[model samples]
Target: RVFEAMLLVGISFSPLAGDLVTLVAPQVAKAASLVFLLGAGALFLWEINAAGRWVWPTTIGLGLDIVVGTMALLATAGMDGGIASLLLINLAAGGVLLSLPKAFFFAGIAVGLQYLEHLLSLAWFGTAERSLSEVSLFAVGYLAVTGLSQLLRQEVSQRQQLVEQRESDVESLSQLNDLIIRRMKSGVLVIDAQGRIQRINEAAWSLLGNPSPTRKDLTEISPELWRRMQQWRSSGRGDYTPTALVERGTEVVPRFVAVPQSPHHSAIVFLEDSSLLTRQAEQLTLSSLGRLSASIAHEVRNPLAAISHAAQLLAESDSVAAADLRLLEIIRGQCLRMNAIVENILQLSRREQSKPELVNLRRWVVEFVDEFRTVQPLGGDELRALAPETAINVVFDADQLQQVVWNLAKNALRYGRLPEAPARISVVARRLPETGQAVLEVLDRGPGIAEKLRPHVFDPFFTTNEFGTGLGLYIARQLCEANQATLELVSVAGGGACFRIAFNAQPETLRGDKLPEP
Candidate 1:
């Protein structure tokens, strides 16, 4: 458009261009040039918005230029020099707009018109001093332009293709990089100089506790992570100190790397889950412990059985005095406790791999509560169960799930009571709406686990009660993990302990037995 406009502007100012531009001069018909200019302007208008639709407009422009050039030549009394050069410019423009075959065809028409004008000029003016060679030179120039433009067009086309291919390759690589980053196990966050999260991967968002998607600031999601990032920036060292949203959550260890100077981002931060590494180490330790317990099982059990059996026999003899009866009772109680400890260790060693199956938790929990109430003494205590009417399917070992719930309920009944108050236990089963996971929560009206001890509550051999075996919670957690479930000590707002078992989401291709219909 600009090229055509500039050509029209130059034509308009041709009179100022003097005799060298003979299209308009002192003796020339200004009206004729005006007509030619109008025709050119009209052709330009016709070409508007047809650049992508290449064929028709270029043909129209070429034909118009040929007819108009011939008129200008004849009207200016064989002004071949000026009209010929102008004709060359028109040919070059045509060559650019049209394909080679059509362009050459138009150039031939202009050549033919040039000869026709020269013949008429000779007859009218009765012999002029112009030779055939001069007219032929203009003809040569037209063909040269058509050829040169075809070459220039081809070169420009190859370069354009190269550029487009390079752009496509760059886009593919960018998408691949994004996919890799999103799938990475370690969390990745790109931060700008203004402390904005310019880019964050799925693992990073999840590690930061899945903050609101619209929150772009780093500090808004996890302040501890932001602080650690600042500390690492100042010292320029590996800061592997773990950060967690809660005491029971997996700890994330973040590492920072300085990115090259960029307007959008200043650094790339990587978050590694230290909890996975810790769990691997813990698994090794437990495996060894399980082996050792199995090795000492026979030796330990024989002695424990003999002591417990002797205590019962001696008590039944009646030769035992009343004062010694208390001592006997203590001895028997200690023996029983020892035997219970031995039994727990054996259970840990002999623990089977989970055979996860689909179970309807709603019906299961109702039946579980009924059995629990029948077996356990519930003196002055309240035991209530709430389950959703709809079936809540979960992937778990039915036996293990029952055992875990039972232990949690027993603990709730035993210690979930305030002084001079009855214990209140509630077993609720429901499906989580957002994640489609089944949840079985056992809540009590007892003092919740202290914040300081919350982290270690699931650790083996860690307990506050003198008579309590710490293995209960630990074993329960192991069983849950074996079934691809999670057990956490949830903080209750009503001043009580609430243990939650978040079961694995229901399978899409569930094929096992469901709770035998209704």
Candidate 2:
């Protein structure tokens, strides 16, 4: 469009079409030059055949432009006419649309010729020379225009560079986020202002058991979920909590806070597993109870022993019958059962709340593996650690951290073993570069969680095992969060599970703070 406009201006200014040509002294010369320019354009077009090679056509066009440019110079003995400026327009067009270097060379020629024409007319021709005042004004105007154009060009170049750089950054961040989401056990959803699905990360798609699709309307695509989300939004500010919406395939969508970055314009919604958290809480409660039971059992054992001794003495009496002896034995058996319950309560209550300490993560994980080996009965070969032994460190409650490790290791030992691949557990610690957060992962070669149960796996008292109080994992999770860390389930590539803990690299070591008594 710009090219066409410049061409029209050139034609209008040319003598053949202008009214001033009739009375002007240089009318004949101008008329002849205009004819030559027109013929050059026509011939250039003719040489470049239609529907054929474009290279020869472009070459011919550039050549005709140079020839006409030279003729226009001869026609203008003085630089009185604004013909030179037209050359600048052509140069810019050529540079933008064709090879940049070639276009620059042409522009250089145009500038050089204009300067030569001006110098020659002043030094020799004496044709239509300008007064001193006019000359000063023209020189100032020309320099000012030139400087302004250069400034604009520089600004345009800088803007282009900045835009490119921002695009690259956004792309890199997007890819990294996608990789992380795909490796998560929880589902994530992102909606636009109009409740349209701007993005659904890999986990969300997989959880829905759907193939990846792009640019779909959230409401039209998933009406149920969309309605639930609307309800969540309508619930007002700071009222966000995890809600379970039973969906197709028994899917549970947990409440995740929707951060309002814009004013009711847009936000992100995260769906985590509430049932899992509930299971964890149950485990914590049960474990506490178990510890109490154990303490009670210890306290009762002395009395129970005395009672059993007295019963034995009574049964041994010569007057006592065989039936009486059987009754005494039954009483002793019931006492033994009560003793076992007490022991469980004690185990549940036994939470080691020692002072938190800063420990080098590399050394700690190695020590933990060694400790696991001593307690667990491995048949023959030693298990290996997959990650590096770097000098990573964190300040955490050591006793609580130990319990977390123990539960993860024990779970792996029980469920991860297979004939082909013997049971193995790996404790790894690494830092997240973006957030500079420390993450610990315990990977196990165990049967991956079932899709249906994955969401509820952390609920307290929710056990798949007959003997399980289901409190071990729950307590671990609670302690982790209490210490300003996050315990999460990471989805692995193969049929296995990974439990990851994300904590601040420089965590507050103090455990003096306590929750208000209920």
TM-score of each: 0.57, 0.41
Shift in Å, residue 107, candidate 1 = 33
Candidate 1 lDDT tens digits, 256-307: 8989867665889998899877888998997898778767865788988888
Write model 2 residue lDDT over 1-518, tens digit each, in one string.
Answer: 22433443354366564543222235434554555556555655665555555444555555455445544544443444444455445454454434544555555555555555455555655653444454445444434444454556567768989999999999999899888876776777777668866667765665555644864676765666667667767875432355434354434554435656766456566666666666678667766765665666678878977887777788778988877778888877766655554543455455445455676666777778888788877775345444445666677777778888888877877766666667767788777779867778888776867778776666544567655656567667767876677788879887688888887536344355442211
* Number of backbone-clashing residue pairs for each candidate, in the order shown: 0, 34
Tell me the deviation in Å of residue 408 in model 2: 17
lDDT of 1 at 149: 79
Q: How many backbone clashes does candidate 2 have?
A: 34
